[model samples]
Target: MRILQPHTRPADEAAARRIQDELRARAEPFGPGPERVRTIAGVDVAYAGAAGAADDQLAAAIVVLDAFTLEVVDSAVAVGRAEFPYVPGLFAFRELPTVLDALERLDTVPDLVLCDGHGVAHPRRFGLACHLGVLTGLPTAGVGKTRLVGEHAEPGAAPGDGADLVHEGEVVGRVLRTQRGVKPVYVSAGHRIGLDAACRHVLATAPRYRLPETTRQADALCRQALREAGTESGSPALS
Candidate 1:
C-alpha cells in the first residue's frame, strides 16, 4: 500500500507547498533510532536519458550497513524504465515509484535511510529526503555534494569543521567539511530526526572517509548495479 497520495497534475509553487506542508505535518518525532543503528541503508539512483517521464530510465540500489563496524550488511538493487518527467520541486513523482519498488526488495528495514539528495533545504522547505522519509515514515537524511539552498563559508582544512547552511535568515542545514579541502556534504534532517542529531549521525558514521559509510557503499553499489544491468550512467551526478 502506498503511504503518500498519487501525484496530481498542475505542479506549481502552491501545489508544492501544500504537499510539503502535509508531509512535514505528518512526519513523526524520533524514536529508538536503531539503538545501535545496526542497519543503515544508503540509496542512490541512476538516470538514463532525461530525468523523469516515461521515456527516461532509472535504476536504484540500497546497501545495508552494519553500523557497529561500518561494513556491508546486505545489498539490494532494482531497475525500471522511467515513467515521469524531470521537475524541480517535484522529484518524488519522477523517482519515487522505482525507488519505493527498489526499497521493497530490501531484505530488512534499515535503521536509518541515507539518501543522496535533499531534505528540508529546499524552496518549498522540502526535498527528496523529506518526501521519501515521510512517505516511508522512516528516518532519512539528505547528503548533497553541493549547496542546494543556503549560504555559508568553506570550513577549515580539517575534517568535522562545518558552517551553517542559512537561507532567508533561517538555518536550513549545514555545510559540513566531512573531509578537509576535498568537498562538503550538505547535511539536513529528512524526518523523525533533529538537526543536531542528524549532523552528529553523519559525522559519527563517517569515521573513515568523507561521506558516511552507508552512503559510500551504496554509491558503489549503484554504479556496480548499473554496470551489471548494462546501463551507461551510474547515478545522478550531484558533484
Candidate 2:
C-alpha cells in the first residue's frame, strides 16, 4: 500500500472545515457489501503523561481481524509524544506519527479499518479518523464513544437503530444505537464512504458488543502495549 500525508495544524475550526469540504468532495460512496470487506483492523491510541509539567505520552495500537470470522489475526503498537500542544480539534496531529508506525507493520491490508475517533462528524470533517484514512487511503470508519461535533436526536434502543448527526443542516455522521438502551456511539465515514454506509458497516461488525470486535480489540491492544513499554510517569486509562 502507499502512504499519504496531509497538511495539519492546531485546532483551527476554519482550516479543518475547509479540509472537510475538500474531503467530502472527493469521498466516494460505495455499497456496503460484506464481500467487499474481508480483513478488518481496529486502531486505538493511549497516553502516558510526560515527565514534569504536562505532556502527552501516547501509544497507538492496531488489531487486525478476519472480516468473515471476526477473529483477530495480527496486531502492532507504537508510542510517541505530542510535538506541539493539544489543540482542540486537531488531535490527529498529536497521535498520527505513532499510529502510522503501528499501521506499517500489518501483514494484510485490511478490507476496512475501525478507528477509535470521529470522522466526518467533526467540525472540520477531518478528525483523527478522516486524517488517518486519507493518509493511508484505506476504507475506514470512525466509531467514537462520544461526539466531537454535530447534533442528533436520541437513537432508538434497538441494536440497529440510529439517528443522523446533523451540523448546519447537513448530516455529518450518525449517533448509532449499538445496543438496547445503552448510550449510542458516534459514527462517521473517514474516507471513501457515506454516513449511511458507515452506519451499515459498523452495525455489520457488531455481532455482540456495543463496539465491533475490531475496535474492542484495538482498545485492548493500546493498553497492553502501554504496560509492556514500562518506565513511564502518569499511567493512562487502559492503553
Candidate 3:
C-alpha cells in the first residue's frame, strides 16, 4: 500500500507529538465504517527485548480473518530494529513503520482493522489504532488489554455487558465484558467507526476469550516472529 502522506521519522518526542496532533484531525472517529464487514484485520507488535534496549528488534504482524467465521485468511509480518525510543503517548512513531510494512505485504486489505491497543481512549485521543486508520484510511478500532486513560464502573457479570469509559468528562470508549465472568477489554473507535459499533465488533470477535480473536492471533504471530528473529541471531530479542 502506497502511503499518501510519507513523512520523515521524527527525531524527538516534541516532533512526534506535533505529528500526532496534526494527524488526529484527519481521523474519522465516529462513523459506522463498513456496513457489512466481511474481513477484519488484527494488528500487533512484539519487542525483541526491553523497549529501550540497543538490540530492541520489533516484529509487526497483520492477520486478516473472515469476519463471520473468524478464520485466518491472510497474514504478514515485518521484522526490523526499533527506530525510536519509548515515549508515552508517542508509541505510534516506534511501531508504525513496521506495521505499515506488514500491511503492505498482506494479500488483502481488510474491511476493518482491530488493533491491540487504544484509539480515542488515549491521552491525546490518537493511539496506535487511530494512527493506523488515519494513515491507511481504513476502518479501525482498538481493543486494549488495559485502560490507557479512563475511569468507569465495573460492568455486569454477563457476556456483552459494558460500561462507558469516560475520560476528561467524555465517553472515549467502552469497558466491555466479552465473557460471562472474565475481565473486560477496552474498546474505542479508531477511525471510520463509532463507539457502539466498535464495542459490538469486539463482542463478536471475542467469542471465547477475554481478548478478541484478532488480538490473540496477531499477538501470537508477532511473538513467533520475534522468536524466529532470535533464532536467526545468536542473542535472543528478549532476556
Candidate 4:
C-alpha cells in the first residue's frame, strides 16, 4: 500500500496540535463513502514499555479483510520506539509513524479502514482515525471500545441499535450496539465518511462479537508482533 498524503513528524505537543488544526480542515465528516465496499482494513497499535517513556517499544499492525466474509486477506506489522511524548488528544503522533510503516508493507490497499480509536468524536475533532484517513487519503472510520468524548444515552439491547454521541452541541458520532446485550462501541466518521455509514459498517463487520472482527484481529496481531519483537506485554497507550 502507498500513502497518498505523507506528513511530517511533530517535534512537540504544540507542533502536533498545529498539524491537527491544519489537517482537520481537510476531513469530510459528512459523506456517502464507498458505496460498494469490498474490502476493509483494521489498524491497531500495542505498547511494550511504560507509557510516556521515549524508549517504549511500539508495534503497529494493519489487517485487511474481505468485507463480506471477514477473512483476512493481507496483513503487515511494524515495530519501533515511540517518537513523541504521550499527550491527551494528540495520541496519533505517538503511533502514526510506526502505523504508516506497517501500512506501506501491506500488499493490499483496502477500500476502507477502521481504526480502534476515536475520530471526530475527539477534543479537536481529529483523532487517530481522522489523522490516518487524511494522511492515507483513504475512506476511514473509528470504532472505539471506550469513549474519548461526547455524551449519549445507552443504546437498545438489540444489535444495530444506536444513539447520537453529542459533543459541544453537535453530533460527532454514535453509541452503537454491535452485539445484542453487549456494551456499545463508539462509532465516528474519520474522513470521507458519515456517522451513519460508519455505524453501518461497524455493525456489518461485527456480526458475532462486541467488537468488529477487524479490530479484534488487528489487536491480536499487534500484540503478537510485539511479543515477536521480544518485549513483554505492555498496556496500550491509545488503542
Candidate 5:
C-alpha cells in the first residue's frame, strides 16, 4: 500500500485548521464512485488514556472485508501515542497519523473505505473520512454513530429508509435506517462518492446490525489493540 504523506504534521490548532481549510477544497463529496465495490475497508481508533491527554496511548485499526460476503479479507493495526492535542472539530489531527500507518500496512487496496466518523456533515465540511479520502484518493464515506452537525427528521422504521441531513442550508448527508427499529446512522460522502451511493453501501453492509460490520469490526479491533498496548506497557487497562 503506497499511502501519500503530503501534509506536514501540524504543531498547533491554528496549523491544523489551516491544513483542513486548504485540503477541504479538494474533497469531492458528490461523484461517480466505484459502481461495483468488491472490497470495503473500515478504520477506527481507540485510546487507553483520558481524552485530550498528550500521552494517550492509542491504536488505529483497519479492517478490509469482501463486499459481497462481508468476510474479513485483510486487517492491520498501529499503536502509538497521540501526536496532537484533542480539538472538538479537528479530531483527525489526533487519530489520522496512526490511522494512516495502519492503512499503509494493509495488503488489500479497498474499493471503498468507510470511517466511523463524519464526512461532509461536519462543522468545516471536512471530517475524518473526507480527510482520509482526499489524502488517499480512495472512494470513501462516513458512517457516523451520531450526528456531528446536521438536522433531520427521523427516518422510517424500515431498513433503507433515509432523510436528508441539512446543515447550514445545505444537504450534507443522510440519516439512514440500516436496520428496522434501530437508531439511524449518519451517512455522508467523503470523496469520490455521492450521498445516495454512500447510503446504499451502508445499507448493504449493515444487514443485521445498527452499524455496518466494517465499523463494528474495526471498532472492536482498535479497542483490543489499545488494551494490549496498555497491558504491554504496564499501564492500566482502558475502561
Candidate 6:
C-alpha cells in the first residue's frame, strides 16, 4: 500500500492543533465514496503505557476484510513508542505515525477505512479518522465506542436506530445503535464522505457485535501484535 504523505508530523500539541485546523479546512466532509465497497479496513492502536505518555509503546494494526463476507483478507502491524503526549482533543498525534507504518505494510489499500475513534465529532472537527482519511486520501469514517464531545438522547432499541450528535449547533455525527438493545456507537464522517453514508458504512460493517467487525478484528490484532512485540497486554487506545 502506498501512502501520500501530508505535512510532516507536528512538533508539539500546539503545532498539531494548528495543523488539524488547517487540514480540517481542506477536508471535504461531504462527498460520495466507493458506491460498492469491495474491501474495507479497520485501523486501531494499543498502548503499553499511560495515554499520551512519550514512553508509551504503541502497536498499530490495519485489518482488511472482504466487504461481502466480513472475513479477513489482509493485515499489517507496526510497533513504536508514542511520539507525542496524549492531548485531550489531539489523539491523532499519538497514534497516526505507527498507524501509517502499519498501513504501508499492507499488500493493498482497502476501498474504505473504518477507524476506532471520532471524526468530525471531535472538538476541532478533526479526529483520528479525519486525519487519516485526509493523509491517505481514502474514504474513511469513524466508529467510536464513546462520544468524545456531543449531546444526544439514546437511540431506539432496534438495530439501525440513530440520533444526531450535535455540538456547537452543528450535527457532527450520529449515535447509532448497531445491534438491537446494544450500546450505540458514534458514527462520523472522516473525509470524502457524508454523515449518512458514514452511518450506512458502519452498519454494513457491524453485523453481529456491538462494534463493527472491522473494529473488533483490528482491535484484537493490534493487541496481539503488541504482545508479539514483547510487550504485555496493553489497554486499547482511541484511534
- How does each model score on TM-score? 0.83, 0.84, 0.93, 0.94, 0.94, 0.93
For all candidates, the clash counts are: 4, 2, 2, 0, 0, 1
The lowest-lDDT stretch of 10 consecutive residues in candidate 3 is 1-10
Clashing pairs in 3: 48-237, 48-238
Best by lDDT: 4
- Hey, what RMSD does candidate 3 come out at? 2.8
Compose the digit string of candidate 4's lDDT tens values, residues 88-177.
798888888899999999998899999989999999999999999999999999888899888999898899999999999999999999
Worst 10 residues of 2 by lDDT: 26-35
Q: Ranking by lDDT, best first?
A: 4, 5, 6, 3, 2, 1
Error of 1 at 26 (Å): 1.3
Model 6: how far is 232 from its true place, Å? 11
Worst 10 residues of 1 by lDDT: 1-10
Model 1 TM-score (2 dp): 0.83
Model 6 lDDT per residue over 1-239, tens place: 88886435788778888999988876777777787789999998998756658669889999999998999999999999888788779888888999999998999879999999988999989998899999999988988999899899889999899999999999999999999978899999998888998888789888888998998899999999878876444545567
Candidate 4, backbone clash total: 0
Question: Model 5: what TM-score?
Answer: 0.94
Cα lDDT tens digits, model 1, 1-239, are 23444434335546655767777676643443445566778888887555646557667888888767777878787777655566666666667767787787777887788888778777766788878888887788888777768789877777778888888998888888777657888988787775667777788788768888878877777667766766446565788
* lDDT by candidate, in order shown: 0.74, 0.75, 0.87, 0.90, 0.89, 0.88
- RMSD (Cα, Å) of candidate 4? 4.6
Candidate that beats the other on lDDT, 1 or 3, i.e. the better one = 3
lDDT of 5 by residue, 1-239 (tens): 76875545887888988999999999998976897899999898888867697667789999999999999999999998788887778888888888888988998899999998989999999998999999988989999998879899988989998899999999999999988878999999999999988888888899899999998899999999877876685766587
User: How high a TM-score does candidate 3 get?
Assistant: 0.93
- Among residues 3 or more apart in sequence or in different chains, the pairs in candidate 1 whose N, CA or C atoms overlap within 3 Å are 34-37, 52-84, 53-84, 53-85
Candidate 2, residues 34-93: lDDT per residue as tens digits? 347778888988777552212576778899888778888888888766554555576666
Measured with C-alpha atoms, the lDDT of residue 157 in candidate 6 is: 90
lDDT of 1: 0.74
